[model samples]
Target: MKLHFKIEAEKATSDIDVTIDNLVVAGWAGRDHAAIEHHIEELAALGVPRPSAVPLFYRVSESLALQGQRIQVVGAETSGEVETFVFSAGGILYVSLASDHTDRKLETTGVALSKQICAKPIAATAWPFAEVADHWDSLIIRAYIVEGGSKVLYQEGPLSSLRTPQELISGYTDGAAKLPDGTGMICGTVGAIGGIRPSSNFTLELHDPILNRSIHHSYAIEVLPEVA
Candidate 1:
């Protein structure tokens, strides 16, 4: 074994998304951590499940005072084990094959992958990134984990109906999920030869099952834990 100073370095990887019954909510400014924590306690007293699949949310957004100001709120209803999302508030609820959402990724100039991921960031000036969410699907994310974060993408596509609760979990049938290149895919297969069987692809078929619902997302993502 080769040893320098006995220090081991880990490669950057973006991988895996898991379902959580509870999620910490944050806003443009900051998350009301204390308020949300208290709410969690209240839900616990009310016998809310330890983990929830269909989330019911109550929240307010910009322009509360002005007349016609809107609020964003939504909930999920379950009957006979079938669950659906009900979004209302801010006038309507909608779902789609895709929607616009913002997030961060890492980019560098010297490397090939970085060059592609940060294509525009390289030019002196360029059209603002058009398809950003797709970046989460293809870009290497762990690069930012050690040093910093990068704001690089936005996603937009046909949005479903407004004024009605749209379904985000329904309609999908089956497909192979193409994860980003550096996705931290665990649980690879093994051959009878007992060698490393590697793959970054997942075969998914949607049914009325919890595993299917949990794996379906409007967007693709791979995330890492934070430093303490």
Candidate 2:
């Protein structure tokens, strides 16, 4: 998948296009072990199986990465969670906003399968990781869902709530310093506010308070009938 992005660096901004062949979704990646367990238990309550390892890495198709404002799902049993997206482009790592839209029903069967069942939406803008590496924890991530024509906050927390990008990249690469070029990963997200539920539209945002800027994207969900 070729993704075009505007790289917002400390000094200048440039447009770059990169091809991503490997896409991985990091799960159970909370910085606090207790919080990680809490999320695990929460999913378990929904019938999703427990993960075999902490910070589990699930490889998803690169084609699933989407920049559009709308996505189609098999049924109404799917929802989106906002997460920070990290990718390497031109030898430089960049940070962006993305939603790991997932099938709640299929999640009970297999987490990996559920991840592959829906389109992953991402923001077209990104900031160079180096620009925010010093205060990465200060970055905030948030998600909102439209329910009954009203936008409600679904999730909100600082990036510190989840594992850092360096830790995630190292864990995924077995102690490697950086992700291979053309690889993109969506770091785990914070728990939902009310609960995980489907919505007609989902919005994701990544705010960098230090830089006084944010990346935002919204997408509508089109639920298609599941004919068995």
Candidate 3:
């Protein structure tokens, strides 16, 4: 399926000349190099192995990515917040919010398989990279999980919590493979408050207070019937 996104360009120009083939997720991309252990400890509780190094890379099936208001999963134990970067074929950059929705059960067996088993949800709205480049560190990302008919803060932090986009892109590419046009990368995320847990509905946003604009996306998780 071709994923189309609304571009908020710096200038009043309409452009839609990009196709995405590679969708990559950069994990352990945090700036607090020392805190990586803490984040690892958090996931290790769920049987996820500690990464061999920082900035671990994983490729999810671009065919499984979704941007609508609702997404269906077989069995997802929890979701995490992340800032998504979209690279245009022209080298222009855009940013949005997304949830690396993962199945905790499968994660224990294999991280890549767990990531693939669930559809990656992203926001339809995106902001031009130039708009917030000067104050990129000030950008904030927050998420809430609907629990017992009320929304509770699941994760919250600034974009600076993780490695900058430049660093992550460089690490992922290693100066070898340039991020091709229409490449979409879901950058790593911060820790979850109150510990990671499951929820039926998940909402998230990428807020740039400097520009006074934000990209928001929310989706409900519907479990499919299991053959017993």
Candidate 4:
């Protein structure tokens, strides 16, 4: 399964191009679930999945991956809310106004998606300078890597507001925020025809909407399917 997504802008409007390369998998007799799931995950190459025999979608939101343009401008130079973009694991898109800013760099942070585990943060190197100067309203703030296992994690943030870096890094509670939890049914029996299966060596990637490029980091994670 090949899953490729590319977002770009032309004529001042953003465009999203998504492609899912569907492939067929042969289920052999006596093969365990791990072996099959491993091969299946490879099909999508990772994040993207084929809707064969099973149904799944990565979360997304307008604030995550979608383009950010002013919903309504109050007055020029008044500094309206900053639009943020996000890609939820559920395949939904988020595009809206809200931000975590600071007077300094590497000194601010977004709220954790959840307390169960600390989500990885990748602040935009081009932020404030590239994104802000270029007027790119949205940018990716964090990325996370979780052990695969037919699970779900809920994210709560993009609080539809703005605050100082000091407040966000310190976990301020006055504004809207994303509080996520990953949960899901593990593996079903071999005869199961439909279910979400976790992946080995799970990896996460984040992008800067304004810069239109991936952040300078990637997180490769290994969890679940423990071996002795």
The C-alpha TM-scores of every prediction are: 0.15, 0.98, 0.92, 0.23
Worst 10 residues of 2 by lDDT: 37-46
Q: lDDT by residue for model 1 over 33-137, one digit each (tens)?
A: 343344344334434423232222212121111111111111111000001121111222211110111111211111122112210100011011122222312
- The order of the candidates by lDDT, greatest first, is 2, 3, 4, 1
Top-TM-score structure, candidate number = 2
Off by over 4 Å in 1: 1-52, 55-57, 63-129, 138-228
Which residue pairs in candidate 1 collide?
21-52, 132-153, 132-154
**On a 0 to 100 scale, what is the lDDT of residue 179 in model 1?**
22
In candidate 2, stretches whose alpha carbon ends up further than 4 angstroms from where it belongs are none
The TM-score, computed over Cα atoms with residue i paired to residue i, of candidate 4 is 0.23
Worst 10 residues of 1 by lDDT: 119-128
Better of 1 and 3 by TM-score: 3
Superposed by TM-score, candidate 2 places the C-alpha of residue 210 at a distance from the truth, in angstroms, of 1.1
lDDT of 4 by residue, 97-203 (tens): 22211111111221111111212221222122222323322433332223354432211112112222222312322343431211110011121112222222122
Candidate number that wins on lDDT, 2 or 4:
2
